[model samples]
Target chain A: MAGTDHDKPLITGGPAIILVEPQLGENIGMVARAMANFGLSELRLINPRDGWPSEKARAAASKADHVIDGAVVFDTLEEAVADLNFIYATTARERDGFKPVRGPEEASRRLRTRNDAGERTGILFGRERFGLSNEEVAMADEIVTFPVNPAFASLNIAQAVLLMSYEWMKSGFGAEQTPFAGPDVMPASKEHLNGMIGHLESALDARGYFRPAAKKPKMLDNLRAVLTRPAFTLEEIKLLRGIISSLDYFSPKTPRGSGNPERKAKVDRDRHGKSGETVKDEER
Target chain B: MAGTDHDKPLITGGPAIILVEPQLGENIGMVARAMANFGLSELRLINPRDGWPSEKARAAASKADHVIDGAVVFDTLEEAVADLNFIYATTARERDGFKPVRGPEEASRRLRTRNDAGERTGILFGRERFGLSNEEVAMADEIVTFPVNPAFASLNIAQAVLLMSYEWMKSGFGAEQTPFAGPDVMPASKEHLNGMIGHLESALDARGYFRPAAKKPKMLDNLRAVLTRPAFTLEEIKLLRGIISSLDYFSPKTPRGSGNPERKAKVDRDRHGKSGETVKDEER
Candidate 1:
C-alpha cells in the first residue's frame, strides 16, 4: 500500500544502472523490469545487443517502460558511469581481485543507505555472452553476488539486478521497517532521522570513514540523506544507534580488527568534475 | 582420487541430515539409501514415530549403518544442536517468521565452511505429515528452502534431505573435481575474494545496507558467503568485478526532482530476511 505520503520518492538519490555488453535484449528488458520493480528509473546501456529500447525489451519491461524510456545508451563503459559517487558490480561468479565483495542485498543496502546520506549510487551488470572486462571491475568500489549453488549460480541479469534493487527498495524507500504507528497510531516523525544521521556521522567520522578534507561536504550531505531516509520510531532509532555504538565503541578485539578508513575517498574526489574519471584506464 | 596432501580433510563434512519426526523405519532406510547415492553419511532424528535405533531402522540403513549406527537422536532440537555452531531449518510455506535464508546449494556452502572452521553443522527436515513447528524453527540460525516454483516447492522429507546432502557431499567431498571438469579452471582465492567483498561492502554501505547496526554484522556475513561460495577463477573474478563495477560505478545521474524524506528509509524490517527463511521454517 502507498503510505500516507504517496507523493514522496521511493528512492532517496540517483543510481545509474550500467550493463556492460549485455548479450540479449530480453535480459536488458528484464533488468529494466527489475529496476522498475524496485522504483529505479535511470538505466545506462553499454553496448547492448538487439539495440536500445527494442520492442522485445519493451515487451519484457511490461509496465517497466518508465525505466526503458529513460535509459541512456553508451558506446563505452566509462561513459555510462561517469557521474556516480558509488558503484557496485553484480555477478553470479566470483571475480578475482583485491577488493571487497558482498551479496546483492548487502550491496543494495549499502547503496540505499549511502545515497540516503545523499551520494549517487549505481549498480553494474554484465553481458550474457561473457561478462565485464577485468579493467572495468577495477573501477568499482564493490561487487555484489547472489548466494547460489556455485555449480548452478548462473542468474539472469534482470534477476540479479531485481534482487539487489529489491533490497534497495526495502531499505532505501523507507520501507525497511514495519509501518510504525506513533502514539496516536500516526507515522513517526521525519526529524528523528536527522538525529540518526548525526549519530551515524559521528560513528563514521570516529572510524575515519571521511577523507582528509575535500570529500567532507559531499560526504556529510550523503550521510544526512542516508540517515534521514528512514522514518525511525524512537525505539527503532535507539536500537540503530545502540548497535552502531556497540560496534563502533565496543567492538571485539579480534586479532584482525576493523577501522573504517576512507576507502571511497579516491572515488569521491572524482565526483567534482562534470565528466567521469576512469581509474582502470586499460581496457580488457 | 582423494587429495593425498595434508591440505584437506579426507571427509570434509557430510550434509546435516534432519529427520523431523519421521514416521517410519523404512523411510529412514530409504533416506540413508538416498544419502549414500550422493556420498552423504551424516544423520539426525528429531522425534521418530516408530522410535529411533529400531532394528527396523538398522535394517533400512543397510550398508549405510555407519550413518544409521552413529545417527544422533534428540528429545528436543535445542538439545540436538546445543553443541553445534550453525543450524538450518527447512520448510516450504510462506510463514510468519524467518529472515535471512538461502537455497540448498548456499546452505551446503555455509555448512561446509562452518565444518571447515571446526564447528558442528546440521540440517533439519520435518516430519512425514506435519513438518517442523514454528517454535522449533526459532532455534535455527538460518533457513534453507528449495528453488522450486512456489506452487510446488514441497518435497518429501527424504527427498529434501537428499538434495541438501548431495550439495554438501559435492562441496565437502572435493567438489566432484574430476567427475565434472567444469571448464578446467581453479576456484577463487582469499585475496581475490577480499576485493569483491570490499567492493560490495562499500556499495552497500553507501546504499545503507547495514542499517540498524545489530542486524548488519550478520546480514553482511550472509551476503559475503553468498558471493564467496563460488570457486572463482582469477580471470573470471576480474571479469565479473569489471562487469559489476561498470554497472554500479558508471552512468550519469538524473536531474534532482521533488522528493520527500517521509518516503525515504521506509523501514519494513520484515523484509530483512528472505522468503526462503520462512518457507523452510514453516514447511519443515
Candidate 2:
C-alpha cells in the first residue's frame, strides 16, 4: 500500500465545472462527490436556485467536502466564462441555430489539448429542467450532448457530471492504473491445483461424502468448481494442502462407525458446514 | 434528433450486481442509478439490513426506478449469485487465502467475454465498513480491487458500482460510440473552420469590438479559439456562414452614431446577450 498511495489524489486541477442555475442542493453535493471520484477539483456555481452554502448540499457531498468547500459562486454565466480559456455547454435539447455539438469523448480530448497548452477550460451544466438557454449555448465555445436513451435522455445533473468527469480522467491519466502483485509471489500452476483437488476429493470419497454413486460425477464437478475458480498463490496452495493433510490424518482407518463415526462426522461438518446434510446423516 | 435516436437505448444486458449485506437504502438507490447509467440491468440484493421494498432506496435511486423495480432479493450471498456463471468479488483488503486477483479492467473484460459466449456473470460488492470476507472472496472466481488512494481506499458502495459498471460498458462497447455526422453531413474541414474564424474575426474587428487597438491580436486569437474548438458538421458551417452574411448585411455603411444606435445595440444584445455589457454600453 506504500507505493499505491501515489495514484490517490486529494484534488486535481484540470477544468472548471460551472453549474448554471442548478436546482437542488443534493444534486450539487452529488456532483462534488462524482468529481472527487475522478480527481477533479474546481467547482463553480452560476446562480444556484437554493443559494450558496446550503447545509443540504454540504451534507450530500459525502466525503467530497474539499470540492464543496472550495466551490466558487458566480452571479451570471458571462462572469463564469470570463476567466475560462475554453468553455463547453452541456444540453440535451437541440438549438434552432448552428452550434457544433460533440459527445463527451471528443469534448474531453479537446479539454486535454487545451489544458496541455496551459489554458483554463470549463464545462457548463444547465438548469435541471430546461438545460442551457439558446443564448447561453451560443456563448460557449462548444456544445456537448450525451448519446443517451432518447426516451429517457434526461440525465440527473450528478450523472451527467460523472460521465464527463470519467471521460476526462480516463483520457488524461489512462484508466488502467490498477496495481498488480509483484513477481515475488507467483500464481500456483494448474498441476499444483489439480494435486490439491485430487487430495481433497480422495479424503471426501473415503468418508462417503459423494453419496449414492449416481451423483458422484456432478458432486466431483462442483468440488472442482470450488477449487479451480480461485487464483491460488504458492502459499495458498500450501495452506490448503496443510488443511487437507489434517483432514486426511483424522480419517477413519477401519469401518465407518467401528473406528469413530463421531470424528468422521466432525470432519464432514467442517468441510460442508453450510450443507446441513452432515447433521442429518448423523441422526440417521 | 431523428437519426440521433438510432443510438439511444432503453436498456442493455450486462453483468449483474450483487450487494451482500448492504446497510443503507440510499446506497442501494445510488447503486441502481450508477448501474442504469452504464446499461447494466440485473440487480440482486443479499440480506439488506433494512430488508426489501425500502422506500428510501427507491427515492435515492432517482430515475433509475426500472432497476429498483426489477431488483431481486435473497436471504444470502450464495442464493444471490446462484444463477451467475462467473463471479468476481470486489474488496480492498488483502486476502490471506489463495484467490486470483484482477483489476477492474481485466475483470470487466472477463465478464464481457463470458457474456458474449452466452454465460451469466456478476460482481459482488460487500458491506460498506469491512469489505468482502476471506470466505466470501474464496467463493468467487476472481478478486477485483480498484487502484484507489490507499489512504482513502474506502469507496462507498455506489462509487464502487459506478467504477465496475463503467469498465464493463467501456470494455464491451469500445468507448467510442460517439455519433459522428453521417455522409450527408460531413465534418467541417480545417480549411472551412479557418475561413469561418477569419470571417468572424473580421466582423468583430470592423465593429470596433476588439477595442483600443492594443488588444486586437489577443481578441483575434480569442475569436479564433471560439470558432475552432467545436466539431462542426457541414450543415453547421453553412448555417454559421449564413449568420455571418446576415451580420454583414446589416453592417453600418456610415459612421457608428449616424446609423441608428438603438438598432445596433439590439443586434449586439441578441448576439452577446449574457455579457450584459452590450446592454449597459447602449444605455450609456
User: Pick by lDDT: which candidate is best?
Assistant: 2
Local error of candidate 2 at B280, Å?
A: 89
* True C-alpha contacts between chains kept, each model in order: 0.00, 0.08
Candidate models: Cα lDDT each: 0.54, 0.66
Off by over 4 Å in 1: A1-14, A173-284, B1-284
Error of 2 at A225 (Å): 14
lDDT by residue (A1-284, candidate 1, tens digit) is: 00112343433134788888877776687677656645667888987777776888887665565678888888976556645656676654554444456654445666655565556567787776556655565456566655443322234465456555555655544433334322221112333333444445544444344554576655454333223222233445444443333223222122122443453352244222112222221110
**Alpha-carbon deviation at B247 in model 2, angstroms:** 90
* Candidate 1: residue B69 lDDT (0-100): 75
- Which residue window of length 10 is worst by lDDT in model 2 chain B? B275-284
Native-vs-model 2 lDDT?
0.66
Question: Would you estimate the TM-scores of all the predictions?
Answer: 0.35, 0.63
